[model samples]
Target: METDENIRLRQALEHAAAELPPLPDLAPLAVREGRRRRARARFAVATTAFGAVTAGALGIALLPGSDPAPATPAAVPSSPAPSASPGASYPPVVVEATPGVTPPDNPDGLSPAERERRAAHQQRVAALLDELLPEKVTGIRPVKDEVAVYRITAGGASFRMAVSVRPTDEPLAPCPDLPEERGVCETVAFDGDREAQLMAMPVNGPDTTGSYLRFSYGKSRVLLSVDPEAVSAPVTPRELLDVAADPRFLDLVEDTDARPVETKEPRPVAGG
Candidate 1:
């Protein structure tokens, strides 16, 4: 019952979403760094998340670190605007009205909510990054609001893992929400259940009162939580450490950061 004009409008919108630029090459780091990260005790976790977890190895370019072109530095800096898609990675529940990345929303693969959930989950993933990493990192940069991109190497996998601090607004368009002070901090922590490494602490000054850790290795780095009043917003580092320390994060972390990895190759999602 849709008008001919409506059909054209929808097709146009779909094409817009599909225009996303290709991901910047994320090649792995050198071999020495990879080995150091694997030995890190942080690799010991429970693996409760299963399918949701990401396990990978390094082969070529960069992980999450390499400095993005100024235009798109953090979070795939310089990435061409996404080509509007008729369908996101997954289909929406209401197929009749599913408009990929368009407004109104769709439940498909990378729905706004799904993207937010995946983004938030990075908190846990970042924690594992800190825990399992033993070598140096490089290319730590800010992406859209509340998010950052790190380039690290471990477990024979060279790649970048985008990390975040506090929960950000759900809208996918805006990101790299830099705090008012606009500073960096580094913190490190490790408990029996978790381990974390932080760098580029998002703060203006050094902090000690609250447990915030920030540090960098090459380009891959971490962001930790800093008492807003104490200095700046650093929920990134704190969350990552906490996630890494979790007993369930061991296997995932090990597989993610271990070098000369035996197994742990990530199977692409069904259609991904």
Candidate 2:
């Protein structure tokens, strides 16, 4: 029941299929797979680079000494200005003002009896500085406010030694809160939990400078400062520290509370 045209069509299709040479072995699929692998490697490298940059930025943000960000400013309202001189024009002038440097305010607060007691304590400290220094100290004493001034000859040069006292809970504060005094401070532990902060610096003077030592004894804090002058050699900071740590010097605080005078609280120093 088949026609000659149907038989011819079937025979033609079989011949075409046989001549196609086995479909050329699937067109080499590994090329597409290799391209995919390379893309993944590039993406991983880029991700690692981005992560490193982010970590570096975070580290900078967390650094201890980094400057704080500037504060945002609010919008300002505009106002009409007066006219300038008819024929004169002036350039913009910028002025930078330096903040004032001042010592800590009276810690005892403002009171008559408290002021008298503080004055008495200061007088005693000044007397002690005069009496207790090493035997080599001698000269016509000069007058200075809040400090004991003495002229001394040492190491072939004559210079003035200024001894001052600063009572505080801690030796120094952090960053801006610390005193503006020029010196390097070091803390050394002593008996009975007492600590002595020793500092030394050569300020603006002729090859002469001072050393400062602050310590806590009993309920009060004290500072003993000494300035020595010499062209080639100056007193070592250790000797000054030893003098400050001496038992005789520490005994000065014994009469603070025992005396009938009311005591003043020490100014607090910022601590880290």
Candidate 3:
């Protein structure tokens, strides 16, 4: 039924189709590629979600009122330790001595052994005075070259005080003979037959500011005096007498009496 031209055209098309290569089946490769892309997308989504969750947890941990992290412990030394030394021996501690006062020579003509004894006794007495005195008396420093004499600082003022035990047959010092000079004199009785004379005299015969006490302890005359000329509110007489009555104070007097550290005859010292 076809004409010659149609027949020829159909023949040519068939020839061309036969000469061309066969088409490949791309369905499996497309499916594999789609699966791979889906897998990569799921992985990216999971990673982003994990990062966001980690960031949120960190932000909550760093908020105010959160507990702080524990601090790191200090590092211990690696070097070997040295052994401790034995305890050291120390001399007896005494109050500071007064400055600029030269210690006088042995005026009592005491033997070398006696001088050493006296020096030791004086040191004991000085230390005792520092302890027994009132708290107001800040310090009690021994005057240079003097025996039993100390420079006391009280209420920001410097004053002189003497505590001496000398061999004497003299009676307790009496109050001032002058009517205007006589301040307050009283007899204070202590335990046993012990007694002391306490006198408070005026600075310039009218100012009324001095403290003096004298008593006989054994064969020695115990004298206690404080000069409060310009000092305001000097140590009271009751305080001075109370100190003299202390058993510890009397014990020192007893020690000195047994082996006298002072001169039998009173000699004027430079500071005293």
Candidate 4:
């Protein structure tokens, strides 16, 4: 397929190649190319190092405080173990018995209408207490069932429990000067507008004992007392607290029917 023009071009190329001087040594060129590649690599490494230093400097400048030590990972708290029983979480707590007795105090001179209302309310509360009392603590009986007062005895434990509900303008009672030797008394904030006082002391001249939990809920105040000596198993502070915080009690306090009648002066009830 070679044409006349192709043959002429091929001859010209061979003549030019023969006429040219011997090819210069190519070792120098190869060495120069390698040097160029090495230089480029060095420049790239230096650029990368400079960029890393600049980024670190900028990060330090943007921090809020002065140069600080590197932060460590925070410790994560473990989840609490599941409780075996619902009551297991609330362990038994017994307030030690002490000497002397503090007779129950009553607020007197309520009007007959108020007394009637209180009596009805007391009966309802007694019913509630009977229902909520522990199963083993049996034979729940009311000794003195009146307006705002309930004295109850359970089983043959030989202990008496009294529950009293009344009206109070104050959210909390001031802490009385209590001696630690006698017993422990604590005043704690129950909620936003309510406070509670818990005292465990001896009753009936140290032979018997009592646990008193007094707390305010909404517009009403409640006092719960349990004589330890009257029962085989004395009620614990935990139990008292649980009872005080019962939703049913709060419902009773908020109930319109059970609300106390506000009166300026106390009036005596004929048979109250």
Candidate 5:
């Protein structure tokens, strides 16, 4: 009894239903997907926070006026300064000693006390000579077994020097008068009537050059002589006279005059 169009419509509906696929539950799949999405989002947030912290630390380190962390310093040892040697200013004093040499005659036959006194005085005179003489004179030493005599070393040569004090009453020996014996002589006048005679003469004949000087003190006659046989340039008469005129030298003469060093009888010149 149904119409033809209605029957055809029912058949089409049955065919469509038969062709459709069966549906499954979607709850587990949706839960798994949501957990995966949340995990990915947490990882992205952690990465962003780590990057920000790294950049901030770098910026602080690179800042222009910021002080860097201090490092430990290494240890180092210190050294001491150099010190000066002894007797650096003045040249050394040398004493000469020879074995088995016949000691020169001690004509004065000075007693132990007298010899001691003379030795002390001679040392003082040697010190003064070292100060007053030219720098070329390297050293002055007393002659062995001799009084008032010194050996001067200068310009790589040895010379003889004598300083003595005697009674003023004893006349100063005149410079040689004979042509064969005479030398150049001159009288130097000092303050007041004080005068000194300076001479350049021969030592062992006319061929050698020597110097002699004499001056009168209060009551004493001080004599100084030099024999520059080997010296390149001998001490000049003017130099010798200047030393004689020094007040310090006069003081030494005064001491000797107060206490006589020579006997009334004349003795051979010292260091002759």
Candidate 6:
């Protein structure tokens, strides 16, 4: 017996046939059309049966309060469309700083505690900067007062590091007032080869308030970065350190003879 659905389908087919395109061979075309329609009906019926079976299985598996385990959801079909990742929003991160205790200064203007504290503080900062690994470098230069600088010039950007000797018996460091986002003291970073480290620190006043940014790279973890001028402010010590430890970029480290990159203050992140 034809179901109500079949009756409705017949009426719909008649309506469509009345509107079909005119063909020259009516009888043969009609026969072909009938075959095509039957084939399509069979395909549709198979597809519908498949869908119903799938739905029923899913429903049985997903039944709530059932003693049996739930069914796993089916894998979504791959689409030609591209989708963005949620974590992609994390900006190219550089580093995070950790504060520490500083020691008192030695006579002659510097204390052993001050130097130790500053060095320790810088170390923490460097650890953070180490996160800036896998960076590209551009140029290297030597500076005055036993100093050198490496200039990084890639990754949609430009940055420089200054390394110098810390006053052994000194009071405060002899470095200069870094521009914004730079610090007189900073942390360190390890190289990809884990061979060398670059160091940077600021030469600013105690009242310095804004966040200081600095980094150092070294051959081993114990090596205090020989380069202090390499430091920049307003950046996490880690990123700057990443640039230092980068080898190809290390060429930018002045050969103690290469032309020095003109000194400039650290710039602020726009609308950051």
> What number of clashing residue pairs does each candidate have, in the order they appear?
87, 0, 3, 4, 0, 49
Runs off by more than 4 Å, candidate 5:
1-100, 104-109, 173-178, 231-233, 265-272
Q: Report the candidate with higher lDDT, 2 versus 5.
A: 5
lDDT of 6 at 215: 26
TM-score of 6: 0.20
Each candidate: what lDDT? 0.34, 0.42, 0.58, 0.47, 0.57, 0.31
Q: Specify the poorest-scoring 10-residue window by lDDT in model 3.
A: 84-93
As a TM-score, model 3 comes out at: 0.55
lDDT of 6 by residue, 199-223 (tens): 3434444332222222222211112
Would you list the clashing residue pairs of candidate 5? none
Q: Mind sharing the TM-score for model 5? A: 0.56
- Listed in order, each prediction's TM-score against the native is 0.22, 0.38, 0.55, 0.46, 0.56, 0.20
TM-score winner = 5
| lDDT score at residue 93, model 4, on the 0-100 scale | 11
Q: Write the per-residue lDDT of candidate 1 for residues 175-243, one digit (tens) a residue.
A: 223355354343334654222445433233655222244322122223333333333332345454654
- lDDT tens digits by residue: candidate 5, 40-72: 454344333432433222121111232211121
Which parts of model 2 have CA positions greater than 4 angstroms off? 1-132, 140-184, 205-207, 228-234, 257-272
Q: Where in model 6 is the C-alpha error above 4 Å?
A: 1-161, 164-189, 192-203, 209-232, 251-272
The positional error of residue 91 in candidate 1, measured at the CA in angstroms, is 8.4
RMSD to the native, candidate 5? 45.0
Model 3: clashing residue pairs? 103-145, 104-145, 202-208
Number of the top candidate by lDDT? 3
Which runs of model 3 end up more than 4 angstroms from their true locations?
Answer: 1-112, 173-178, 265-272
